[model samples]
Target chain A: MSTLAFLGEFGEAIQFIFEGETTREGTQVGGSQFLELTVEHIKVSVVAMVVACALAIPLGLWLGHIRRGSFLAISLSNVGRAVPSLALIAFFVAYLGVGFTNVTLALVLLAIPPILTNAYVGVTQVHRETVDAARGMGMTEARIALRVELPLALPLIFGGIKTSAVNVIATATIAPLAGVTTLGDAIINVSGYGDVGRLAAAISVAALAVMTELTLGAAQRAVTPRGIRLESGRPSRRRTLSTRIGRTASP
Target chain B: MVASAVAALTAPLAQVQLRDRSGGDAGCVADDGLCPGWIADNFDRYVDPLVQHVYLVLASVAIGFAISFALALVAHRHRWMIAPIVQVTGILYTLPSIAVFFLLLPLTGRGSLTAIVALVAYSLLIIFRNITTGLDNVPEEARDAGRGMGLTDRQLLWRVELPLALPEIMAGLRIATTTTVGLATLAFFAGAGGLGGQIFADINFKSNVVVAGGLAVLLAAVLDAAILLAQRAITPWTRARAA
Candidate 1:
């Protein structure tokens, strides 16, 4: 096809995405509009991340504070890296039937390991001297964990959440496989929208992922304590997080 | 109660006996109705796709490693380039695999080429980050010593820097390889032909899903192990020091 023809098809698909349409045969499908699909994609990704954070953060914090179960945390992260997200979704869909809940659950499983590992690493990496000083000042274990460790660990915790957020958003593109309508609906159901639709959906998904990464990265930077911000001569937390994630995959 | 709930949910899906439209077998079973005998009978069908999947992974990782290594080297020398290069690759990495596959389809057409492009893009961030970090982590003392010994920059990099960086680089390669193996499964959506096509062909079939998915997992494990062994072989000092 000519480049102009391709662009015309792409423009038409974008129009279809904006202005909801009905088929010539009069079937009413309400899910493919760009705004609606974006909302669905965000909803699924946010819900999955929320669920992952709810489970992983507290557990990761407590485990890190206690400084035990390093083996478990490390192993879970490794296993998470090893398993394919598509396989997880397929397994859930096969057993649970297709729905938002099944996809969210699969994505939650996908998001957890990173958050957990990061939080664990974040807390554990807090200075030993700092913790000891807090203890010497008569702080309880819980108090020290909350007052001393949590604040210091916020950057890495946010890093983990940011990682999971980006991952969940990217993986959420497969939501259509589980009958949940997301941006992927355009690409997966090619008969419904054609090449234009696939390209547009791909564009939308990539934009969404980049947007999520930037937004969360800003949030991560914002949440870093002023003391740590002043310690910026150290390697930035973002690079550390990526390297940690990379290393954890192999170890 | 959970078991019954699962049974209730799955019962309806079982009735949908999706025919294999790809002309492999008309007698494919539904969800939960995996016929082991049928899987054994049709084992050969998976071999071609598995081989394709391996080729897809190897080609992508090889290309990705080369590009990432060069980029890492450039960024290492010119520190100003690292952030922009990382940002660009990070965005590429964050893009969904399915989206990338289809997006490239228009420009590259459907085949191994599109699949490799997408897979290579996905591998870059992991490999690039590791390579740069590995290079950066080379001890300043070691570099000074190499310079003191009158080693040329090229010789120093080849002999001292790259060797020391092997463990990290190998870690990156292992992650890239295993992750590529997983992502390659989705390349079937772009008509690239891999285990994903087989799994998608009979998504509800337990035998098909298990066999295809298992092979993908097995391939990941084997490749990971092979990389680990290669790392040990290349960095013999690491093991010797441990001993």
Candidate 2:
């Protein structure tokens, strides 16, 4: 019955895609169908991203201010960046098994590094003069960082978050492989057939993903305070070597 | 320093020792006979595809850079093409790899060609934007000087703008290569080529010794090292500036 319907729908598949098509599995493919799937993907990804930001931003700021854990913090973030998300996904699947929770965990793991790295880099790279000036004015350490370093670091840190968000959103397409409903399903569903309809649907969803990525990116850009430029001076000599190591050791 | 030294020396080693002694529970790398040998043998299977993967990345980057350069040059001259071009590529970027794979699968089938085409598309935007940025960074005075000296536009671009743009171009290339290498893992899903094949094969079996996790790590390390070396080679300005 489903095959018959599929064949019936097949004639007008391209035209019918936006409207739903009923298949053998009793599943319907349409705009609402895609919308629901996309929403799910977005929700899972966003939640993970938010969690990552929550943990990463404060920790990143703190780590960035202190000189001691700079190496470790940087290195940890690098591992997050350096390791392939798929590899981590696979490792997560191995340990946690396949599910939304597992996939989300993998994504969160992937997401945290960039946010942490960027935030840390941004704060640490804050102009020493600016920091000194704040300190000279008798601002507390916390106040100095929150008022001075964080605002200056905002653009770069946000850039990292934006990059990570795009990455995770794109990666979330893989969620379907583990039996989660996502935009990834659009790709996997069309694997057996040579039909371009599924491919088109997949492409459409990916476009949506990219659109969301860009929208968030634009938001970050719009909010970026213009004063920050790449700090011209090299990091302290000790920091320079560690930064190199940190970059290589992780992402 | 002392506290960190103690933590560093003890923590990781203790964790490994604990996991090893515990035997079966560690998520990665199991204690089995001939794990290293199994990894070595599988790593051998990877050599050909790895070369192809490298070739694919280098070719895509070279081709993409050239294509983007031409586009950037035209767009720069025309001015109006910039927004539209960025918009189109931005759209292209959001399209997932799987979507690209399946979309091209009809025209190209499950071949390395499909991967190459997708990779080239992916590289396009990065290189294009970077090229334009680098070109834009060339000072107006420099362009005026070239004009006053009676240099042709082509000569000016080739001799002056390109040299100034070299570091930025190399940075874009570095990003392109790394992105391509990572994306190449998706090629394995198509069953055509790359180290992803070995990784997937082991993944399917859930066997650690056979899977060669260490080889994958090594492969990543080597690829990263290659990029670092390439970055230094291509951007002598960075090194000279550092000195």
Which candidate leads the pack in DockQ?
1
- By summed lDDT, the worst window of 10 consecutive residues in model 1 chain A runs over A23-32
Tens digits of per-residue lDDT for model 1 on B72-144?
Answer: 8888788889889888998888888887886675567667898999999999998998988888778899999
Query: What digit string (tens of lDDT, one per residue) describes model 1 on residues A1-251?
Result: 45765466557656665664665567533334667889999999999998999999999999999999999987887777777777777777666778988899999999999899988988998889999999999999999988999999998888889878888888898788889989888766655654556677887887888888889889888988998887764766556555555554456
Q: Which stretches of candidate 1 lie over 4 Å from their true place?
A: A1-10, A20-22, A27-32, A234-250, B1-31
Interface RMSD, all candidates in order, equals 8.4, 13.4
Best by TM-score: 1
Give the per-residue Cα lDDT of candidate 2 at B232. 78
Write down the worst ten-residue block by lDDT for model 2 chain A.
A241-250
On residues B77-193, what C-alpha lDDT tens digit does candidate 2 reach at each position? Answer: 887787788778766665666567655644465567878888888878777777666776677898999899999988998888888777666656665666676677666544346
The docking category that best describes candidate 2 is incorrect
Residue B223 in model 1: shift from native, Å? 0.5
lDDT comparing candidate 1 with the true structure: 0.80
Q: What local distance difference test score does each model get?
A: 0.80, 0.65
